[model samples]
Target: MSTSTSTAAADRTLVTALRERLQLDTGEAVSLVETHISWVLLTSRLAYKLKKPVYLGFVDFSTLAARKHFCEEEVRLNRRLAPSLYIGVVAVCGSAQAPHLGEGDPIEFAVCMRRFSEDALLQRLVPAGRLELDRLEQFAHRLASFHGRAQIAAPESEFATPDQVGRPVVDALARLRVDAGARPTRDLQTWIFEQRKALRTAWFARQRSGAVRECHGDLHLANVVLIDDQLTAFDCIEFDPALRWIDVMSDVAFLTMDLEAHGRRDLAFRFLDAYLQHSGDYAGMQVLRFYEVYRALVRALVGRFRVRAGAAQPGGPDYLACATRLARMPNSAPRLMLTHGLSGSGKSTMAAALLAVAGAIRIRSDVERKRLFGLEPHERSIDHPTNIYSREATERTFARLAECARTALQAGYPVIVDAAFLRRDERLLFRALAAQLHVPFSILRCRAGEADLRRRIVAREAQGRDPSEATLDVLERQLATQEPLDPGECAAVLDVATDAPVDVDALGARWLALSLPPITRRPAGWSAS
Candidate 1:
């Protein structure tokens, strides 16, 4: 018999015996799903994942010892996100001809996990219209928290720089062209290389500035599920450290690329906004599009691999189209909008809403102030006198905000300066900056009743880890000294009442539907209602 035939027969025998030997009370039989590198046996409420003896440039599992070690690693890493889902690993003993569970010497290793209904997967739910906005926001916050806690990749690590990080993308594109003869991937491939040329410098700077970290490497819809009413991510890359240790934006780009591939670009925007809010990592946007292109092409190449292996993957072409769309994305000219309000007047909330709908990058006082102090966004109350909101410190904070806004605006991205722009000079500084950049400018005056604002100040301070350090005294002082907009600013001002729900998407759609040139395309999920 041929070698391929012999291997297939051996695999079938091993799978059948595994189903019989593994203890499960599935009334009838267990179903097995085979992927390129692993076989997953599904029981009533359990899953057994056995790695194939596959060798690839990224990973090697050809040896029995290698499989065993990776099985243990999978359990250790995935438990961080899905502790309850990943149970433990087990040894398959006896023989491949008639294998018995844990009887003789170890032959194969399997990672056992608690399996739940597949319908709850975010991949499935998004297409079916069951994944709501609130749930997506929740998932974003959870992922942001995960990134915050993840260990930053050391500078000395081999995969700690952009050239090293993009090696896989380069390799994947080469494979796609070689396997998919005359597939017309040159245009898409050309655009990807162009973006590489544009973002190569920023990519390295981001890694040097600590944006690189150990992240959930394979964060796609299929690996994420809504378990027990919570969105849970599992099955991270375990065999390859190069894939797992990456710039955080590269990790976020994978899911967004997946969503766009499914014809759901609207959710992709929402997810990105939510994650940016929670993580306060706006600087990483420098390389976001670069990674998005890379990630989309990776999926496209994988689809081709499946097709060449005689597997049915009809969505492969759609993935390639997504890659081209991402690469050819038009650069929207920068625009500036500053928030006008006291500390607790809902400026941040309005800013977040505007960002979600308008596709604007936000620069916040609370975040940048801390950044000026070399502190994390949530780290507060250090260097009491110098960090205690002195006049000099406040000026320095706004200066840093302007610097950041300048960089983002010059890069052709719309910006939202999310600060308590109570001082006339501070507000005027950004307005002048917008004029200098020759972009449309607007001021969002976020107003709320004093009673509500005062209450909110107390509540916000009570919530520990809040970036804002505003107190009752601060609120009262702000109310006393707040300046009104000048008559010259009237034509470009927007008054926003923060007392109720504000669907900024719909509002933005209506406001920019005519007369105004939109900074970004309106979301398909929203209308001019």
Candidate 2:
């Protein structure tokens, strides 16, 4: 018999035996969760994940040995993100007809994990109003740390190369056409194919630069949980390197895409802002929208599959709309917002707040400067303005910032240039770039009482957690050397005092009104796809 045919009978028998093997109390009941790929058995405090013995081209578990090996791999890979949950692998020691839980020659293997309240899952929390933007900010930081420590992809790995990255997108759209009618998404597919050149050139460089790593491939809200009052991720891709080894942004894109699919663009923007602030992956913007569009297609296709199998979910092909919308160049009022301030004046903070509101991609000098020389955002090897912050280095840093902004704005996003635009020339560079692109531009000039700036610098030094290694001396120099904003720049200036708490939304609303007019209706030749 074929693997599929035999597994059906085998799974039925295994389910019966596992129901008994768990040995629940007489009054309690056993619950089984089924999916296309695996079967999960919940037994009070533990969860047993049994891999279906079927071979999908991406993952094969057609034999006893294959199952055992992949079960072990799952525990190892998932533990990095869900450290306290994945217990280990357990063997179903006896025959399927009378499977023993843990004492005989092994017949099959199942991954054992600690079970938590289903309420903790993000999928549940999002609908119950328990998940909030502030909480997602914290979650973004935690996920960034996971990406920081994950194994870098092998030097020759093509998992993140454009061909591999684009393959799943092509496959998904094909499935969508066959299952949901081809007429709806013909334009979207055409757009993606036509833009492949630009997408591949920029994103492929990141892969070659070691940005690809073993990441939590399937990072949708459902695979995440708030265990022990801490947000955690689990059930990572283990059976296929092609799924797990990817650009770090691709991993983040899954969550952002999911949030957008659920009609939570503001929360999605918040998550992306916090994550990018922590990670400093500004240059990843070129790949972000590409992967987001692809991820949306994948989710859309999954929903369609479940429906065909009579698993009609509440949220239908909303992601199809999401994918199509993202694949096309959005009607964004692309604008440039540059930060002008002394060090420790809270430029990054203000920029972060603006990003959450505007959905703009931010590029920070402190972070990007360090990134240029092969450093993590928070890793420090030398003092500011001495080694990496030399005059020449600063020039390179600003140049990098300008290039990144140019690319992101061209790709249809508002851009936030986060730096001390302390010099008129520095501000002019961005101003001219905005003019060149014919986008609206603004300067967010941040200020604080000198004493407040001093106090912040001192406290920042005490903690030593910040990427900006600015000292009081550097701030003094900045104040002295800073060129005042020209009269011509006044029309676009937004002054912000950063020392006290203020409502960001109030300012954001004013800026939005000036720059982005609300869309009253769709333009000509508009189709939902």
Clashing residue pairs found in predicted model 2: none
Question: How far does residue 62 in candidate 1 sit from its true spot (Å)?
Answer: 1.7
TM-score to native of every candidate shown: 0.84, 0.85
Q: Which residue ranges in model 2 land beyond 4 Å of their true spot?
A: 1-7, 24-28, 132-158, 180-183, 315-317, 342-346, 370-390, 448-465, 468-481, 497-503, 509-529
Question: For candidate 1, lDDT tens digit of each residue in 1-529?
Answer: 9986787678778878888765444565688889878999988888999998878867898788999999999999998888999999988888887775565698888999998888998878987899988888788888988998989988777664756756666776787678764253677777666666777788778877788888899998888998878899999999989889888988899998898788776678779877876676777777777677788777777777667788854543367677777666433446778888887789887777666566567888887787676666667766545654888989998888887788777765678888888888787777667666666777788888888898898888788657888888888888799887777666677778887777787755533332333553222232221
Give the per-residue lDDT of model 2 (tens digit) for 1-529.
Answer: 9967787898789877877767644245667888878989887788888998888887898888999999999999988878799999988877888886687898878999998888898888877778866678888998888888888887676677878877777887877888755334688888778767668887668877778988989999888898877778898899988889889988999999888777777778888877876776667777788889888888877777777788766744388888888877753567888988988888888888877777778888888889788777778857544588777888889888888898889878888899988887677777777766777788888889999999999999999878888899999998888888877677688889998886788867666555522422322332322
Candidate 1: residue pairs that collide = none
Specify the highest-TM-score model's number.
Answer: 2
- Give candidate 1's TM-score: 0.84
lDDT of 2: 0.81
lDDT for 529 in candidate 2 is: 20
